[model samples]
Target: MTADPIDQALFPPFDDAAGFDRIRADLGAFLPAIRAVCERHGLAASGLAAFERGTNVVVSNDAGQIIKLFPPFLRHQFEAERLALGRVHGNVPVATPEILREGELDGWPYLVMSRLPGRTLEEVWPALGGAERAEALARIGEIMTAAHALPTGGLESLDLGWDAFVERQIAGCEGRHRRMRLPERLIAQIPAYLASARPLLPTSVIPVLLTGEYTPENLLVTQTGGAWRVTGMIDFADACLGPAEYDLLGPCLFLAAGSAELQRAFLVACGTGIADADLTPALSRKLMALALLHRYSNLGYQVRIEGWESQASSLSALEQLIWPFPVR
Candidate 1:
């Protein structure tokens, strides 16, 4: 409708950029623009390289820092991340990014933060042994536990009220899943299943900050005496405030890969014990509803376990399959 203002020689031709495909398709093209932000901030000599993962424009260098950019339409994520990193930095067990500088570039907001060490758990999960995986999940649980315990009295930016958020998600649950091409079997059960699970969810529980970013993608791991450990956590752009269980969906469905032992370890360490009489089944049901309601939920893509589709004949079946746990 109007003229593009960014220097074409530097920034990608992001005109009418509706989806991430354009960015992902030619990520290198945006490096000049990425560097322009650095140049503006006087950190341009650090030699940049693009990280080819996830949505968003990201680049890092050997200067012990990284830069992340959120498109104009996604500026809310930039604000959310900036606030989240500050709130949980020293409070959580694992290391989180420390913001060094932040500013907007031609309508795209960017943050230059202290880069954390260790490979991402997503990069190493497939190779880790049983014990290492267990330990990693356990550590993740601890980080989450500490986060949930932090005071949430006045952080309105992070508090995505669980009630209203869920209401909206429920309203569009069927349509969202349908658009995502979820199987008709699961799609058909959305209404009654969520209604049945409503009694299991909390209406008055103390709200906690929810990052929804604890998956292998965000978790960093390093070896400690031959065992992998979750050393750092990143990507807080999707952070919000909500019921604690809502945060667990990422770890349970993504990193645990539907394993009873690993999922139970994570849930237990997260302070929601999976043992009998500890509300595992009820909690599992609650999380299932959350899995559908998550802002970025795409079950078919996020859940990593093989054969899950075959096992998930219904919503209840899916919950049990992913959260069998120490319930037995």
Candidate 2:
């Protein structure tokens, strides 16, 4: 007998190494659970539907509200998120979702937030030209700097120490990539590559509020004066304290999408100048290692370069594959 699938579950399956295929498969039952939450919280539930994005059981309501229900295992993200919203509201150039309330639901923790405005930059990227893409990238870069420039007052409480986090990531880098199905050719050289790149990660600088994924999907943009501009940044659940450069890898790879010119625009705007020829190689390798070690790194989708597995003979070549230029 197949016990009712959704009824058979105690909580959302742990967001562990296995991932979330089952949740999506049983979304119909999940919707009712969300509706119950909405009913209890007194938030609109008329149009509630699974948001169908990211790792959690996120659902949206008609009243410009989003409710993200995190599994017990991802409770750390819940903590990081509530703190992040309060801190970013008035401090940064853009707006993050305002937390209306937070509490437990059927043993799961959840947050109800006021959704911000503008279409995700990702939804509009394919329609944007080179000049428009460059403009959007540059604006997002400045916003990143502004967010990073703020004093890390209470953010340190995220409790993810940089030294330990980097060491943990460095130690697990090889195993992680192997599981993520990185090609053998590239996987073989990870140890030697990370050894050289280790020194490039800075330990002494004042830590910045490091958002996990800084790509266009998290950035909101609107057409302003006939040019698209970044309006707001969203999704801080996976955020914590880390090096500012750690935040750049996503946008550099996903937003730039293998264009050296765009990569240069963003890196320069973020205040990491690449004009000096000597800095590019070192920067490239450091970012490559971080990309592999990223908490949510998935090279399958993040690596946009086609035929890269066959083309990139070594980690250095793969770095060039992503950065795509010697100097700009």
Candidate 3:
């Protein structure tokens, strides 16, 4: 789960009575469609329960795991997903969602994953205060570090060249922008940013540990015996093979929960020494700008046009990601 910049501001309250009612209403309409699919796949007895893990999750006992449904444009994301999950299968101390089946129902493709047992970090984040929050983040850092520590040869091979990768991302953004009916000014900034930034990209490349989405929402924390450990790292649908620096950017935005020191701690845990060159304020700015541009130009536009209230807050978060400095 990557942080939705607009998640907090734009989504309906999930814990509230009204919000749950709305959820049940949507589930009512979707369940039958899902049930039909499950039957086709021979998992009919799988009773489904909705989860609040930053995306729509339906869990069924007989179905083997939870099933995730994203809008159509995201169908292409599954390739990166299977690859990421394969990388983390045993080395990382996390449960990767198992993709049992995938296909479109009512025109939207979905992935059914094996469910892991535990509550989401969101359920406990608020109760945790200063040090406790730090501990939780440390645990998350450790899990992510273990993930990055694993060999990258498999992920590396799937790498689309940087130039082609950027072009595809830009095209995706442009298509979504056109569909969302965004303000022309926002639409116009797309090509201008690409024109300026694409030229500055380095000629070389590096192996990256990519888990495309790395936000608190996608993380599941549970207690084993007495200590807390990261139980699951779900939703790899957007996983990509790109710059090593790119992997840490999302945790810097949402998982650190706005704490610079925590973000530093996470980098340290990953064991990939934080290069002074990469941490320069200018570099952070470049990464942040690219992140926002990518979201607004592509992912953000997808959520807006799809009218998915849960991810609306993601758009707002983009502002924070782009400008971590205090306003003058």
- Top model number, TM-score: 1
lDDT of each: 0.80, 0.77, 0.57
Candidate 1 lDDT, tens digit per residue, 148-168? 887766668777777787788
What stretches of model 1 exceed 4 Å from their correct place? 1-10, 15-18, 24-27, 272-276
Ranking by lDDT: 1, 2, 3
Which window of ten consecutive residues has the lowest lDDT sum in model 3?
1-10
Q: Which stretches in model 2 have alpha-carbon errors above 4 Å?
A: 1-21, 24-27, 271-279
Give per-residue CA lDDT, model 3, range 26-69, as digits (tens).
55545655665566577754566665334343445454566555
Between 1 and 2, whose lDDT is larger?
1
lDDT of 1 at 300: 92
What is the descending TM-score order?
1, 2, 3
**lDDT for model 2, on a 0 to 1 scale?**
0.77
Clashing pairs for model 2 are none
Reference-based TM-score of each model: 0.91, 0.89, 0.63
Best by lDDT: 1
